[model samples]
Target: MAPQRVVPLSLRKPTHAVCVVGVEMLVDVHSDVPRGARSFEVAGSSGLEVIVFYDPERAREPTGRFRWPLHAGADVVVSVDRASKDVNDLKVKVSYFGEPESQALGHGVLYLTGVDISLDVDRDRTGQVKRSRGDKKTWHWGPEGYGAILLVNCDRDSLMSRDRDFANSQLGSLADLQDMSPMVLSCHGPDELFDSHKLVLKVPSSDSKRVGVFCARGGNALSDYKQVLGPHNLSYKVERQSGEQEIRFYVEGLTYPDADFSGLVTLSISLVDAGSLPEVSLFTDSVVFRVAPWIMTPNTQPPMDLYVCSVVDINGSNGKFLDDMSYLAMKANCKLIICPRIENRNDRWIQDEMEFGYIEAPHKSFPVVFDSPRNRGLKEFPFKKILGPDFGYVTREILLSGASSLDSFGNLDVSPPVTVGSKEYPLGRILFGSSFPNSGGRRMAKVVRNFLYAQRVQAPVELYSDWLSVGHVDEFLSFVPTSDKKGFRLLLASPRACLKLFQEKREAGYGEAAQFEGLDRVAKRSINEMLADTSLQSDSLYVQKCIDWNREVLKRELGLTEGDIIDVPQLFSLKGPYADAFFPDMVNMVVLGKYLGIPKPYGPIIDGRCCLEEEVRSLLEPLGLHCIFIDDYLFYHELLGEIHCGTNVRRKPFPFKWWHMVP
Candidate 1:
């Protein structure tokens, strides 16, 4: 094994005041000094001084450039301090076997490698803290601060066991050492701390140079280099010839160590003229820095020639249709091009619609996310030319070049039941027609009823209907919904037949069998009356007159005076049916309670108005019910089904308190 080299990372001749250029002060020696080796000490108030040592045997007056092997089983120590002239500030002594000094000066570069840092627990162990590297460009939460002891590697092997053994063998000399674990240090200043976390150790680079040991904390006799590095199975030997000059270096079996270097750190040694000469000194200075990792920002503007056509009913708007297609593509693990273009009348519009892809920008949105598709470039599709006359006249082909997601299909319908395989109808229903009464209870009931009728032959499945007309619901429930209900086993005839029956009945003026006007009429009835005989509640009314139901509940609950009429239809306009349901519950609890003479909480009594009343809470508690108090009825599924509250509120509020039921 070649000698392991050690460089002074920082150095300056002893000056008026003690200053360290490379690493911090104290240096550790691995073994006892050999006979005839000279040690150097500085004592003075001079501005700057240098330490020079050399062997006349190797080359007289050691100067300029020279390399000496760091032999195994050798240890060298260098000490420096502000020595006063009165304390016999300087002294020099030379013995036989130790040669004369040389005078040479030329700068040489060193590269440090094969370094190791390890951790170990102490007896009656006290805990040590080390920070782990964090994510880039973001602040991170920190743990409580703690001190870490230094542990260096002696055995330079990859396997931790060898290093442990080497470290243990050196533990005997470290009795005063309180901890044996390696100190993992971290840069904590607000600046980019990651940069300073690394130590760039430089040693005279050579194939023979095997490894080096280092510590930020000063090394003492109590510090066991072997115990700290025993498990590594590596070693370093340094000998000061001719009073600490011509420092000999050597290495044994060793391995590489891990480093999280994010910053630039400098480590170098200063060359000098003579060995065994007076005024030999040690210098140290360290540079600290923070580093920032590279980051890439995205182009925020939507691409030109890309326009989004939104299809609302999963049936017409191109925009809506595209959304569904994107969803399907995602499910199939298919990648697609983002920002596809769509023709609007005569002008081409590009849409930045980003909802389709993964969104990383906190407030930014994108239509598609993932790897770009296999092809690129804009394409024009002339549906008539490629897909035949079945395709419309405006045919333009979308040219895809390179990897991209954009794909062109001559006006192919991509809506429901469009499975990848199914022989009967290779392309399932692609055309989406317009729907009336786009929202609300009327829309909901019609959608549900239609879906139910379509799948009448199958088990009655809940139609996952949002808002749609009665006719569409009939078609959906009877056929489509039933087929997808997975094997519940109840089926009904086609939707067309059911729709005919319903229209015929309506024409005959028979009306709903419940014989009710609409939701308005149903809401008009007192809560007490509805609760007493829920059979009187009507589904048709709940569907047609939601405002009537809403206003009636409101009037009853608030005790509206004459001429206090509210615009029923306009007041109830909102997007979600679920939210609409909440308001009705508010009416139910407050009005019913007021009519039944329920008392309100007395947190407020200003100006004759009890402002902070809990009347709604008091009334709904006993029935395991709570009013949303917003303009909707959001009863739980169990209550909605069992109590049939919307259609049948015949039962009195049940006898339970709000606290009695566990949420």
Candidate 2:
């Protein structure tokens, strides 16, 4: 290989600064000066003056000598002419006092402009300049004000790194630097802050150029850039120069109104020199800021729709379920939609007669319907639609088209639809009793899974064994939305847990011992009833197994622990035979946003009153949830229907976006 050629270098003093127009200032320079040089001349449209100081000490008077080093590297101070106009480009030439020969420094230029730029790194906690590679800085910006702008000045060769040995072998000229004109500056930040298109540059106007402001894209930038821009929009132009492409943004028509932006934004600025063969780039430290209109998800938003049926009368009063539901609708400020029972064809009129359960979703053009339950008729119930939202009319068919041959016991005991996952990405899940292994089980599972996939819901499908007469997940479990980080917590009905709490209360000599005694007696009687029924002895075993399985599944799938579960007092009674068996299950409740509608237990009254409601309230109050008693005993509990069976909730569909799914 031939001997390697060393590239020349250029250096300038006062690397960066901000100065006003018509201001005279002294700037220093250390370049390849000829032997016996005496004077120097300043050139460039910036109109700066060049007055070489023979005594470096005199040049260091204005700015302290300590700050302005006068040494072999920077020997002379070039003064800005008092009459010089505001410009961006300045150059220097050195000459000998006795000789006429003068030579320009090897490609060195001082940037002098009217634009005011200041950098506040780390939110003003420190003003230390980063000197080492990979040193970073940060700033916070908002709609009220723009982020800081940094003044950067460096040599063209230093800006680009190329292997000279390989470049010379390729036979290409490496001295060309003018192509790097009009360097591009950009920014990157968090998506929660400003729009991805957030890098902005404000250019000043002069006799040769007009003032203009431009912007580009940023990383993790906020969504809805057009909305953030408000009435003003961004326009772009593409230009081809020196067989290269240059994309520039024009912001003359753009406006930065205070109302247009909000949230925390972290931003970094980068300078791109397009002149280099592969382009050269430099990045400044990052900055973070808080903008206005910080959008946040509400702790508990009100339910939008409720699903109720008139097939079964709750609370022993026939033809009153709809009226009771209508009252609930008014209180919750939501629309009530009725699912007429197919078994009672005559009840079809009840759908029109009822004055609730009818309303359109926010974006939906027509009223939503809770269609008749498939195959199993009214027994399986229409609440099964709770599996997921009907994305469109076609989704309704998918929800209703499931296995046809559901047994009477299986049909009535299908698990109530349970929703899991965050409010932003809710997943609809259901539990089926393994004993009721039928075509409907497989078909419904597949349909729900496909529906969730098609809708792009980010929830997983899970199953838990069911063995009780009312073999429904809702009979023993529920979910309540919360402001906590987990978004919601699991509500489980555990007779064991309830008994333990009551026993502890009794041992502590609490005033409610008599009430606890009655509750405990009722619970033991119910358990005894199950153990006595030889036909359900096997079921009793399955029930315990199912409970354990569910608890573990919830912890694994929902990321929940024992602390996340809210246990409600409940008991199972097999008194009236298999079909008549019912659970005075307090966990089988209806959720209307922040209000939890539960059944008022009508078990053996103690001390001339029932304290089940009080006990349940005491358990829920600490979690910031309110309880509403729905006197659902005679018509619902005795008839195998609980609060969840007699009533259903059609929650407000989440406002989901593609980007919101990202952690």
Candidate 3:
């Protein structure tokens, strides 16, 4: 190892300071000595070791005393093995030799004690309750990726706190401390060492606003944690009581990692020389922590609970829709939660209101719901009803500018865990829609988008979705779990596939069968009539081209081949330049483990079974997925929505620990 520091030992008087065990300090020797001095002699007590090296081939450690001829380039190295329990217990002396003993220089006394200081964190993804001395700086991903993990104090554990715990600097309640990570400072030395020297725990000015620290002053009283180090205060003079060996502090992240910030905050303790005019640090021990990112669970994770809204609007009633959902929930054995009309205010689109995510650390983990800025009927539902105890609430609003339809979370979805080439998205990548090439169109709020991008773990991929009426990603694409080669498959709505299916049925002598045969007020047309209509034909082809563009992007960005994607037979009608589902949209379905609740596409009854229903059943059944078609036509399909738009699911988090991955 290299020397801890370098000091110029003055020959005029004794120098007093503190020393650390096993640390080497190089002393500048043979400088400013008398011109005719023939030799130099150096010696130290039992606690200290002295080394004299002037020759490259041979370096000597003098056990008792060292005497050397005057040389131009000789250097001295000194170290200590034991601490000095009393003042002036250890001393080193240097003398100059001239023609007579009367011309010799006086020796200086160095009265110092050696102290061992260590600052550590959990390099493995486990809790450091047992005090593991692992690397606290470098953070990477994989089975060998090592670093300490931190969770943002975003949740309110105390009902007395009106806001999230991180928002306030003062300690509001005792329960709020459960959201933070623990850090330990181990200092070992003699009791008399601190009588002249001092230690400082500090944070750089640049990182002061990003983290908060609470004192662990060993007691049950809430006032014991009154001292907090954060944006207002950057350093703390360590209050080391007599015989105190170690001290602990609780660290909490104040804000999320952003583009300007890397989410890595470091805390350091410096041993300072109190006797100097402008204090100088003798040694510094630092530790690094990476704040946890908000992660979204994909549809593949096992569903824990499902949510929906009940409303009797001017156009439709969701009573039947609720019943069908209840049946599917029973079949999947998942809990069903329905928001009454009084709370929903006739707005039935629950999926567009909010998105579900969570943040985790080595010691604690909890769910966090991201409320959208779209102030609909369920605008206050997430904060007022869902946020309680360990559950968290987060929101980003376009305060200066109003929100657009693209701001709805219906445009947000995440892919399953994927291995793209050498890169692995163990938590999957986030997918959302925007008008990228066409800047004149409506887009998601920049504030919301920036919040998503700051979560460095799941890199987000943007897609163009402004061509539709609702401009949501759920209208055309979805993902479902399977026991096949990829473990899941991407389902895309393809107009060309629907046309091909109709052509095959027409060629098979079923041209007389019509679509939407029993529905009231809905246009019912046979295969021959639909195929011959040139206006519908051109719109179908145009819609197919738009979907094809997204298909290419998804395949390239998600690293999927043609075999990994399954096309659902769907047709669309053009309203001006925007498109919408002509019948019931089957692609927008609710996924729960291996069970799926799909929209009932009312096609002609052939062989006593609906052709479109059998089509979807044939595509997904072979992969061990159970499809249950629910009647969401009257309430959702006609309203430009489907099952997924009317329903939402909160699923279990990924089994893999996020700290193991390097982003």
Candidate 4:
């Protein structure tokens, strides 16, 4: 077949290329398509260069061309050369891309404008509280934050006095954190309407983007009724960035009904979005907000282990309050557990069994327990039946074994006693009572004392009190003198009352020697700081001291000195009444451990926490267990002997000796 013949350009041929004279026009191309369709060849000489369109799907490849200086009736014609590849076998059209140029991007061109508004209340923003900077050319967000009205006079370079003060009053007080200054858009002052100016409002986002909108008075800012906006409205177009987000606040007729007001609206350009964004606030003004995808935080992989601790089954009117005691025991390791009360009067032993069962579980122990009835149904008790082979039984067995000491102190040795039925099992004296600040200090001393005994402590248990609540502060203060036994009642109340008492005593002639003479030297020092600085009086000195001590003890305990400031807000993070219970000894842990630094042969307990059976295998991998089999004075050392021990054989650590060898 013969190739198509090319049409030669001549005066008889239609001259111009595709010209968009009216709404649209068509141009035809012959056979071949070209690789680079750079310029078009038109028959007629036209000075103007017009844009050309190809198939919309393939925007970069234009099949044909067009001519400019188009009139309503003009039709464009293109001369396709056979040598050109791009123009072969195609047709194209030309037309106006968008609306007419008379309208531009928006309804009309916007000019420089400003507005004035008023506030009805007193305003405060940190240091700038008393002073009004209305006529001040520009305002800055102070170190703490800012508060103000919604008006500005850029032309005069000053704030309108009355309107400025009114705006300030509406601002109230600036907070120390996020800025939530509610700018006064417009206000009615008693009788007259003052809608005579334009306002410059800076809409700010937390992400530091700024949007300045000109709000005119008697318009949306001050108008009471809905009004149609003129074509001369602001024409700012924010092309959405790849991940940019937006929240719009609508002012009734001024803004679309649906708008996002998640950002702060401040007169000052910088701090407009410091607190809540104007986008967020617009919702409060009868509009809904839609947040774009750009504003969201990137997603992250979820955490694996949360490490929570919970105490099981605290049974009592208020004694169960220690349900979260495990929270304290584990420190920040996990959350606390809440358990159901086991109240079978006859099956009291079952309750004991249940308590021991939980103690043996892998999780830490909490002081919460279920209240039980007197001895009636022992065998049929539900608590005992909870000893499933899977968990409960093993836990109970572990507890029983741990409590089974050769010289372990039992219930018989207790003082002040455990009340079983009508029998008072005197276990130990109430050394101190840490009052509960919540409810009446109901049986707090008795329950804690019993718990201590159950945990294997024989006598003299110290008690902590919750002194803050509605009542019972004075009652606890009275027990300060006589209960100063070992681990006695450590008064863990708010530092407020403690400082007040110390101050009163100090000013009245007697210094530290006046009250609570038995308190340790550190406690005395804490009291001194509290008395000296009135500002620190309300701050919980005891809690602070505990935190300081904990930091020190943890440093010593973990052998960490360089990065020692790990645990903070110690009391707040710990769970339980005795969270502050161990505070007295926190400072002493370092002092005690310093003398025993890394015992010879690394002595028994490796690391800090006592080794459990599960962790023993891994730990033995590095340093084999130091076991000594001394038979009739002939001693032999066995490395990793625990691994080979028989099922019935018990593993024990070897005594420190100079002859020990390194792994």
Question: Residue by residue across 18-44, what tens digits does model 1's lDDT show?
Answer: 222122222222122234433222221
How well does candidate 3 match the true structure in TM-score terms?
0.93
Alpha carbon deviation, residue 408, candidate 1 (Å): 18
lDDT of 2 by residue, 284-396 (tens): 22343321110111114357777565564332324665677777777778888777655444232221111111111111211122232243334322323322122111112
Please list the C-alpha lDDT of all candidates, in the order they appear: 0.22, 0.38, 0.82, 0.22
Error of 3 at 278 (Å): 2.8
In candidate 3, stretches whose alpha carbon ends up further than 4 angstroms from where it belongs are 1-4, 30-35, 47-72, 80-84, 98-105, 129-135, 315-317, 436-439
Root-mean-square deviation per candidate: 27.1, 18.1, 2.8, 29.2
Q: What is the model-wide C-alpha lDDT for candidate 2?
A: 0.38
Question: Of the candidates shown, which would achieve the greatest lDDT relative to the real structure?
Answer: 3
List the candidates ranked by lDDT, beginning with the highest: 3, 2, 1, 4
Q: In candidate 4, which residue ranges exceed 4 Å CA deviation?
A: 1-131, 134-181, 185-265, 268-663
* TM-score, model 2 to reference: 0.42
Worst 10-residue lDDT window, candidate 2: 250-259
Q: Could you tell me how far off, in angstroms, the CA of residue 141 lies in candidate 3 after the best superposition?
A: 3.6
Q: Write down the TM-score of every candidate.
A: 0.19, 0.42, 0.93, 0.17
What would you estimate as the lDDT of candidate 4? Answer: 0.22
Model 1, global lDDT:
0.22
